[model samples]
Target: MAAMLFGGLLASNPAEAATAVSSVTVTSVNSGDITASVEGKSELAEFGEAVRDEAPELAARSVSDLAVDYRVLKVDMKQVRAQFAPGVACVDGDGNSRAEDVIVAPRNAENIRYELSGDAQRDPNYDPAKQGNRCDPDLFWDEGASPEVDDDPAASAPVRPYTEKYASACFARKSQWKDIYGIYLEVSYNDSCWSDYVTKYDGNSSWNYYSVKAPSSCHIARGTYLTSCGHGVERNAAKGPVVKWDDWAPAADSNGDCRDKGISVSVGPLSVGGSYTHCEKQNIYKYAEDGKMSSYWKGKVTGTRATQHQVSVRVAQNAGRPRWTHWINSDACVCYK
Candidate 1:
């Protein structure tokens, strides 16, 4: 019975509907016999039968003696885009050539200014002696020029600047439950369908573009069982997105279309046996940007993030016995630039 219930809960088709037992009314017959009037779908009927078979003593208990708990799980996913401008030559107050700022326009329309110039004095990450002339790419139009010309007529020439744009895709899913006399018992499992981020580009230039593929899908499954002590138990499991990046190949891939990363996740089991509640959670954040404007002229960038939470609880029956309940909730998001 437990195996069958687990299989049903973990079914791949999250769209399937399964109703829980809502209420159970007890009545006394003229013969002084107690009868339970159960109200719910097949799942609830099976639950009642399981309880009776495991612990016949519970058959005489009234609705007030049996406690049921309900919890809802929700999942969501979304995508966003970021933009960057072309490189430009810059000079310090002393008239010496310096690394130009890499202007980035995040999704919030706010600009994040930074420099890739391998100058120790400017960026602590760079070693000027080892990484010679790292400022040429940001200071000169022709990246191949040797001797690093400090002043060139073409450096001041008019050039196209990067444009700003936005693109996104979103999806959401929630667990279903049955209401039993104001209490809830989760019965059905649900999951978000596969969603994709359509490619989007700036109208001014095809070189400037943004998008994300291989989006994310969320899953939630739950089942009930009879404990050794003849008590009821509910278990839940769920997973969110884990993004993976492709190998970097500049010449073969230009628009960053090969950048779509895959997704994966691993969730441990959670069990609560008493009146206490327990929860486990995980959060992830990742960001990737073009290394050089010349190679990835599109200035594409991306951010992938996700969060997950699993909760479990055991309700105390009228006789002080424990009845377990558990659920999992998660969400994933991808930001493109």
Candidate 2:
């Protein structure tokens, strides 16, 4: 499950480095039992405030770009039980209390560790002799660009100045830590979706401009794709090498429609199909107003286009991209060269 734990406090503008502490309330529960408390000396409140005011862009980051850090402290439950339900008391089916599960001083440890790293090493063996890592959710907050706003009141988008920085800070955090063996909690974060709204859309611009509206959707799938086929602009689930790849935007006309025009794509690892090939027939279609596919494409190629990369059909061409047959489950759809 994803958890979005926003700090309830707000700080001054975060254009500069300033630190302050606020009382942080942490509530933990298992099954239906909840434990809420205001811990001492936690930077959570300060971190939460900085996240809201300073790092608007960080709020737009996907769940993949988030990490949680902090420590978990334990105390003897036996002392408080006499006044409460001392020890691990189990409620019987008839609602009767059983004291067998209760323990007074059952092993107490100070802190635990956790991380979200991909290699799985983030989860370490717990040792009371060692200081385990804690979950500090504030570390994942980035105070870079401001949020993007659309006509929609809730469309708050974050700007990523650099991709690597976003990935390193959130996407690849250590998963877990080892403090006192045999106890751990999996790290989690909320998935922030796109908030920018589309105000105006121009389907027919000399430059094919769509009024350049605000961003409204989170980039669901982004990264490089390599296939024996070339990339098509149609949102096809099966046409491209990877399925459901829909994050690509229209390529600027200035780039010369590098791929859609059959020009070569950046040649890189030959992981899919070694070497380049001409797209004997290349096209990019769209789902139209009438809910029908667009016409076939008219274009040309010159450079050595690589396999399975997104390409755009230029507006200058009389015809647009081909009807995405993959939409109809037709194997006739072509993706690679």
Candidate 3:
């Protein structure tokens, strides 16, 4: 009113609109682009909602944070938390690393996982953290000669971990009675050991076995702490022994040594009974000619050398039980001492 003069200017051309927009400097770049205040909008939430509802696909295409898909706003935190609870990693076997994701065979997974990590409570082959069977099952030691828990004979026996997949002990077998069950053990380091463990579907089924021959000389003697149990079959003059063993120190015994970088077992025509033959040792120098010192056990000594030898034990099919021999390192044998 004092000057009684007023003038109004409106944007009439694209150049004018651009000049007006340039006049207002952008304070910040939100999301991937600059964000500006919209006229007459107290809060940006309402405008964002309208844009998303009208052009959902377009809104999903981000242009700064000013516009976003309704899906983003509708995230369920609880669902997301459950999805990533335990971290996941990938592994491959079957000699293929780039195959499509498949549900791992739980049975094999349980064994492989336990072999990699499981609690081995007893059994000389046991390692609490590293659960490879360091000792062979057939190479058991005399209870009086080895370690025990509270003098409990049963406790000292190796405790096989319960397999999560099979819902039973890692070692399981079918029983004599079709419906009954039994535990399985691997002696020759093969699944054939399970043959006797599984229930027989037919009554006249025959039993097949895999056996190892004793060494000719004691590879593992009293003083040899690094020695482990091995197996080979002693054959006639023209035939050779079938050798299978674990050379890995921690698992050189009957139980498979799982920790060794590279370990394997082999089977051949080695007879357990053929291992021990003509096995006699005499410290003749210590005793006179009339009194010859000799050591003997109930078996044949097939072959012998200064520090290595092979002995044989009989596998009698008596008491309806299959008897097997312990092809052990001399240090692991209690028969001599």
Query: Which ten contiguous residues of candidate 2 have the minimum total lDDT?
Result: 209-218
Per-residue lDDT tens digits for candidate 1, residues 38-153, read 22222223323333422344334444333231111111100000011112111212223221111101112111111222222232223332221222211111111112111111
Give the per-residue lDDT digits (tens) of candidate 3, residues 1-337: 1221111111123332232210111111211111233321212233233234222433344433432211111112112211221121111111111111001111211111101111122234433222112111111111011111111113344543221111111011000100112211111110000011111111212321222212212222222121122222121212112222311111122212122121211111212121122222211011121111111111212222111222221221121212221112121221222
Task: Give the per-residue Cα lDDT of candidate 1 at 51.
Answer: 36
> What TM-score number comes out for model 1?
0.18
Write the residue-wise lDDT of candidate 2 on 1-337 in tens digits. Answer: 2222112222123321122222122113201111122321122232232234223654454322321222222322122222222122212122222111100010111111111111111213222111111112111111112222221122256432210111101111111211133232221111111111111212223211011001110011112111111111232222211222212222222123433332222111111111213233323233332111211112222222222223222221122212221110000111134
TM-score of every candidate relative to the true structure: 0.18, 0.19, 0.14
Model 3 C-alpha RMSD vs. true structure (Å) is 34.7
| TM-score of model 3 (CA atoms) | 0.14
Report the backbone clash tally of model 1: 6
What overall lDDT, based on C-alpha atoms, would model 3 receive against the true structure? 0.18
Error of 1 at 95 (Å): 77
Q: After superposing candidate 1 on the true structure, give the runs of residues whose Cα lies further than 4 Å from its correct spot.
A: 1-163, 179-183, 186-209, 212-337
**Backbone clashes in model 1, listed as residue pairs:** 22-180, 80-336, 81-336, 82-336, 82-337, 301-337
lDDT of 1: 0.19
Stretches of model 3 off by over 4 angstroms after superposition: 1-206, 219-277, 281-337
